[model samples]
Target: MRVAIVTESFLPALNGVTTSVCKVLESLRAQGHDALVIAPGTSPWSPTMTPEHYAGFPVHSVTSVPVRQFRVGLPSYEIETVLHRFRPDVMHVASPFVLGVRGLTAARALGIPSVAIYQTDMPSYIRQHSGPAGDLTARAAWRWIRRIHQQADLTLAPSSAALQDLAAHDVPRIAQWGRGVDSDLFHPARRTDPGTAALRARLAPRGETLLGYVGRLAPEKELHRLVELARVPGTRLVLVGEGPSSEMLAASLPGAVFLGRREGEDLARAYAAFDVFVHTGTRETFGQTIQEAAAAGLPVVAPARGGPLDLVEVGVTGDLFDPDRPGDLAAKVAPLVGPEAAELRERMGLAARDRVVTRSWPALVEQLLDHYALAIRDFSRSVA
Candidate 1:
């Protein structure tokens, strides 16, 4: 089947949503399905913008302009005009942005079923960053999202937590479309890298421990907590991404090493470079980075809340710390600081890799195809 994916963010940006979509598209193509992607001309998540191609898909760019406090690209009507000619069997809208709204409109005009994926909690984001206008911001976001998603043939959520949240917001016909990890690319074996050896030697030259965080250095990530974990003397913190908050975070935690953003083999090596992986965010619908960390055979330390709760099996894969206490995160990760921690890391990392391998991209794409078939059947009958 041919499928068209519409997301407000893509290639030029690096985030969970964009990454997941790319992986799924590749997986679908491997299974003999055709897929096309449409994304914003400029990404709000990254500063350096460059257009690129993916192996299995073609991407089209829409509007390039600033929206609200951030610069974002709007949807191009020409995209819809082109997709109409191609006539995909299904259209999936990945974000509840203007592009996504256009996806729904275009799909409706073509009498084709469309699915919307609830990837982020815009309401919560507004509440966190909208200052005193947070209440108005949240309400506005809720209204906008409801209008955009209510008409979708099915709404896909990455986690059960997200499903419950969307239900509360009155989103209709929801289905689970959990994110997956590339077991082949992110396994413990990929950790072999000159860069990893070099970084490890410098940070733990005298046998200090390495603790890592891999994702955007944005306000929503709760990275301050990760920085605070650096108080433990024998631990060297490695942050593997850059965002608006990178400079401030670098200043706040002087001992921490910022490696910018690494992708493919480089990213896997970075994950394996660390003794333990840490996450403090409570807002993730699903944490693909956490899964990638696990796939690299690294024990994880994350909040007991959000997607990590679903991925990290406490005392088995990794320990879950109390989100309220950054100190608890430090304590949970401290065991790995000792020499004995190396054995634990290997054992836990193996288990972590095993768990993530089960969520492979091909399997996830096939499952989503099943959901599409089901949605089409149900909607066709309803209309009949």
Candidate 2:
């Protein structure tokens, strides 16, 4: 099938949405299907920049605004024209915000099957950014989001919990379209890298337990609570990512190591070097970093909320503590710092790796194609 993907985020800016879009496009090319991407980019045509291509497929780079210190493209005016020429069998939109909203509308006008992946927890994010008055803004955003999504053939949520939230909000045609991890890139084998040892040593001086957190250093992530984790005796909090929240987080989390965004082998080493992975984001639709940590053989200690609830297997793959309960995070992670630390760490780490073995990109893309076929069939039936 020819798929037209209009995304809010893409290359030159790294995040879960960018990573997932690249993976899907790669899979589409490998399976001999036509796919095109429309996203915001940092001047691939600029004098300093070399062109950015994904799996030999062309990307229609457009202008976008900065969100969480990254560029998020507004929908292009030429999208309808582009879709007209491509005549896509389906339209797959990632985080149906600006670009996606337009893409879904065009898909309807063109009478094509379309699916919108609800990735961001924008309602909660709006509240975080708006304070007490943001509730009205969040409600308005939700209504707008629901309006756009209701036009699509289907809405693909990243997890069951996320789908539940969408369903509760009266968004129809909700289904689960999960995320995948690169096992080869992020594996236990990468831990033996000399860089890994150097990183651990640098982050945790004098043999402090190295606890890691990956993803944007934003308020929505609730990273301020990381100060609480750092207070846990002999534990060092090492954050791997950059955001506007950096300076403030650094000032508050004194002595905690801020590696400021590591990618490729460096990112894998960062994850493997940590003793335990702690996630504080309660609004994640699909925690990509959590899966990457699991693949790197680090047991996760996440709040019992949102995407972590679906990804983490308590006591086996990781531990889940109720973040609503004060000190619950400390209580769950306490055992890892105790006398049986060695045994529990090894057991949890191994299980963490074992659990995500099937979460390969190929398997996920195949499942996605299945959904596309179903959506197409259902859409055709409805239109007929």
Candidate 3:
């Protein structure tokens, strides 16, 4: 099958959308499927860094403008031209916003079926980043999102919360499709690896419990919520990844150890070194980092909302705190910290790993292909 992936973000942008797109492309390549990527050009911050290709597939970059630390792809006739030439069996629109809207329009014009993947929680993002006009802007963003997804033959949401959100916004033809983790890369064995152990010792030098959080250190993440968690007795906070809120978060978090952005083995080692994984963000459409942390055999402590609701199995695998209650985070994390809870943490960590062990990228990609087939059939029926 030939597929065309039109994404809001891609290479050089280390976010959830980019990570999932890369995994999908890799899976498609391994399965003997032909695929191509249409994404924004490299941001001005990293002018020459974006790749011309990925997963052995050609990546056609469109003109883009900088938005904060990231680039946003603009609407272009290039999308129609690329789709016309590729003659894709299905078009995959990843996190439909500006670029995605154009991709969906082009697909409709060419009589091609398209699947819109709902990954980002834009309404919540608008509310978080838009200052006082946040509520009004968020309502407008929801309307925009509804129109964009309604254009696609099928819309795949990454979690139950996302699927429900789309349905509530009156977006049609919705389905649930979650992200996968690399169990081999993020495994229990890594905890004992020399490098990982050394890293853990460095972070928790005084035999303190290492509580970790991975992903961008941005405002929307609510990293400030961790101030109380950082103050927990017998626990040390470790943060991975970088973003616009880094310096501010560092100052507010006090003694928390920041590891910046890490990838591949380095990222895996960081996860393995953690005694517990804590996620502060309440607006995630799907918590990909939670899956990675769980795969690394760490008990997760995340907000009792959104994607984490589907990933963390409460007391069995980890714990979930009420996002509305600010102090709930510290309360939830307490059980997974300190030497007295070591056995409980270990059992929960093993359960967490077990929950995600079968959720491989290849398996998730197969599910996506099934969605594509459904979209194709739905489109054909509509035309007939």
lDDT of 1 by residue, 10-119 (tens): 77677877887788788887888888887777654656653555655777777667654343556557866879877888888887577788888888877778888889
Clash tally, candidates in order? 1, 0, 0
lDDT of 2 by residue, 1-384 (tens): 899988888876778898999999988998999998888767545433313567887788777666656676777668888889889999999998877888888888889899888999999888878977899989988998899899888889989899999998999998998988998999988778898888777876688788889999878899876767765887888899998899999999887888888888888998988989999989899899999999988889998999999889988988998878878887888778744596788788889888887899988999999989989999999988
Query: Cα RMSD (Å) per model?
Result: 2.6, 1.9, 1.1
lDDT of 3 by residue, 145-187 (tens): 9889889999999899888888888999999999989999999
The residue-level lDDT of candidate 1 at 192 comes to: 67
> lDDT scores for all predictions?
0.81, 0.86, 0.93
User: What clash pairs does model 3 have?
Assistant: none
Alpha-carbon RMSD, candidate 3: 1.1
User: Could you tell me how far off, in angstroms, the CA of residue 109 lies in candidate 1 after the best superposition?
Assistant: 2.1
Which of 2 and 3 is ahead in TM-score?
3
| TM-score result, candidate 3 | 0.98
